[model samples]
Target: MTSPGVAPGLLRVQGLCSGYGRSQVLFGVDLHIGEGEILGVLGRNGMGKTTLVRSIMGLLRPTGGTVELGGRAIVGLAPHRVARQGIAVVPEGRQVFANLSVLEHLTAFARGGHGTAHAWTIDRLLHLFPRLAERRSNLGGQLSGGEQQMLAIARALATNPRLLILDEATEGLAPLVREEVWHALSTLRQAGMSMLVIDKYVRRLIGLADRHVILEKGEVAWTGSSAQLEADRSLWSRHLGL
Candidate 1:
């Protein structure tokens, strides 16, 4: 299911349908992210944004459709299997271990991934996230929300994942902290780390992401470049309530 200009592999979702019990959330959602591309996922609350992430991460089983990561179907696979397949997710919540030190949290990923020479190492991650380095010994629960969010990102990078999925990366951070998080994401993009970013800041996403996909009622209603999205504010006000 290669899209025009999209290589064979990479992250591709085609007609993905998912739900919790009888409550169907995602309906025929289709989207893709390519190597070294930063793709934005945008939508208002209750629009199946997280559901799509869950389905991709194997946190939820898709009743219908396919999820192909790196040219292989990952639908119905366990979360660990999905992670092993080069997909690391920083979920909506930081979800860090309350008692684990920052160092321990990252070091736990013994089976590091991302085979490239510039793979993410703990030293590199600490350099990318200086705050985490400063709090290397601090327990996850001892950090502020922003710090925890940084830890969450650094922890995921530790796995050396080829694809990084960040759900609400800066959801509850202070303005300054939000800016920091955004800067880190931008840096990752520049470093050629493929990303699927879901943030409330639509304008920021449009500026940073190479492509944008807007979901409506569990389906992709609009997919285009930043320039295309910027030219049409109606799309924002309609699907995203921007």
Candidate 2:
């Protein structure tokens, strides 16, 4: 079920199906992201974008299909176990703790005792998002939407994951703030970080992701390279409701 021309690389999700109770959302969704590659998930609202991510992260168990990371089956693993397999998620809502300071948020969730040379440290994360550095002593509730989003991303990176999943990378932020988030993503890509990014900004996704997958009615409707996607506006109008 791999998309044509997409190598099943770092992360591979095949025929993945999941739902809440009896109401199914994702319908055999298939996608893959290679090492150092960014894959964009696109669709109109309620097209199973979040469900797909939840399934991949083991937040929700799938009724069928398989999810593999680096060739290891991770379908039924607990959420934390899946995360320990080198995957981290920046969830859709930018869920930062209200009482936790920026510094605490970074340090609390950081994966410890595995100090590689390139492991993400607080210093490195601060360098990535200087705004977080300036607000180190401030509670997560005190930061603006943009700053919260940055903190969420930084917190995920603190895990030093091999693969990162971001649901709604830039939702509900000022245009300028969105750009800043995009810039940080670009920086991560340049550093050879693998990412699965779900964002509403189709144009921005096209510019950032190496390939794109469009979901419709809980299924993957189309998937192709950025050049292929850019050339087909009809795909947008049909699947994404652009």
RMSDs, each prediction?
Answer: 1.6, 2.2
TM-scores of all predicted structures: 0.96, 0.94
- Count of backbone clashes, every candidate in sequence: 0, 0
lDDT of 2 by residue, 1-242 (tens): 34455455789999999999999998898888887788999999899999998898899999999999999999999999999999999998898999999999998988852334577889989999989999999999999999999999999999999898999868999999999999999999888788999998999999989999999999998988899999999998888778
Give the clash count for model 1.
Answer: 0
lDDT of 1 by residue, 1-242 (tens): 23356454589898999999999999999888888788899999999999999999988999999999878999989999999999999988899999999999989973556676687888888999889999999999999999999999998898888899999998979999999898989889888898999988988898898888988888888999888889999998898777
Worst 10 residues of 2 by lDDT: 1-10
Provide the lDDT at 198 for model 2. Answer: 94
**Which is the leading candidate under lDDT?**
2
Pairs clashing within candidate 1: none
TM-score of 2: 0.94
Q: For model 1, give the 10-residue run with minimal summed lDDT.
A: 1-10
